[model samples]
Target: MTAATQTPMLAARNLSCVRGTQTLFTDLSLQLDAGQWLYLQGENGAGKTSLLRILAGLALPAAGSVHWQAQPISNQRSEYHADMLYLGHHASLKEDLTLTENLRSLIAMDGLKVSDAAIQDALTRMGLAKRQHLPARVLSAGQKRRGLLVRLLLRPAKLWLLDEPFNALDANAIVDLQECLKAHLKDGGMIVLTSHQTPDLGSDTAGFVLSLSRGRA
Candidate 1:
């Protein structure tokens, strides 16, 4: 089926979150279907990261609930997680492992098996082929970011939830990532990400920012 006719991949109903007596957001709700994109805009302490964690099934919301494909994410966590990719600001990469090893380890957790040539090709495209054998701890900040991004290329899951993905990326890398995101959307993949800096996703792209402070899109 085409993305336009498919059910929403993610849905949150009357969600609320409070951290240490501080209400980050309350009575918030949103839905994301296939082939759509969501950009989160908020300042520090506005709960952008917190909300992303909640949606990604990593944190519990203070109130309300989220569903994946009409099933509560908590109940269908395995299925939900299998079809999603959550990229945090600091991706949990093993510092001692080389970039290639890290990518293989992470992908394997999702029950995916990829060939070495394919993985090497993806690293090469990220401009990391030469450094793939080096430990992630020794890589530069931008190189580490690029290494984590390789997960996106290897596993084109249905839902992509990225937190501060543009941080530490250079101008050219940023542009390349934007094009990659556009291609994913065109393939009926959905994405929800936060970026402090504005992104130019080409003139034909369809996207809108979901400002967290007001819980408005």
Candidate 2:
């Protein structure tokens, strides 16, 4: 294959974190190539969210570095962000804005614009078509999860860092998202996420998981 077609890779080395003098974890390292889905598993207080935050560049690792395509992400901040997407446990949507409005604003932040029809379609697929006009504050926790997931359909990225992505999704919504992830992997996207629910991807895909616990005993 040509260089243009080669998939990208994300790597992290010697990552560690601390919370109020409590050492979470250390010496963590991993690499994810395009078309791979990484699942993070751990008990509560195992620093799963903290690890995801560091990898997403939302937080600094106490003693490590992250790289994309062999280049330190810090040296290429904007370029890295342009191709990376991070979705925290919270929806990150504005309660004052309707579903479509929130999505519109998110896209605009990336210097892109989508039509109302496009926004509605994404919401419809995520089972939020009926609530597209409703303010986000009125949506239940589950609905808020689905609403935030609608962003995935609206924007495509090379790397996705999701924390507890399947937390509030229902049976059908979970299935829909699993399929969406499979397709993203098929398209050579790299996803490093934390999900308690085991995603059922087709046999044709490649993925793995890393379990996080406390520091070495």
TM-scores of the candidates are: 0.93, 0.93
- Give per-residue CA lDDT, model 1, range 1-217, as digits (tens): 1134345678888889888878889988888886778888888888889989999999999999998998999998888888889999885789999999999988888788999899999999999999999999999999999999988999968999999889999988998899899999888888889889877776666676778774332
The sequence of per-residue lDDT tens digits that candidate 2 reaches over residues 28-78 is 878888788788888888898998888888889888899888898899988
Off by over 4 Å in 2: 1-8
What clash count goes with each model?
A: 0, 0
Clashing pairs in 1: none
Q: Candidate 1 at residue 63, lDDT?
A: 92
In order, what lDDT does every prediction score?
0.86, 0.84
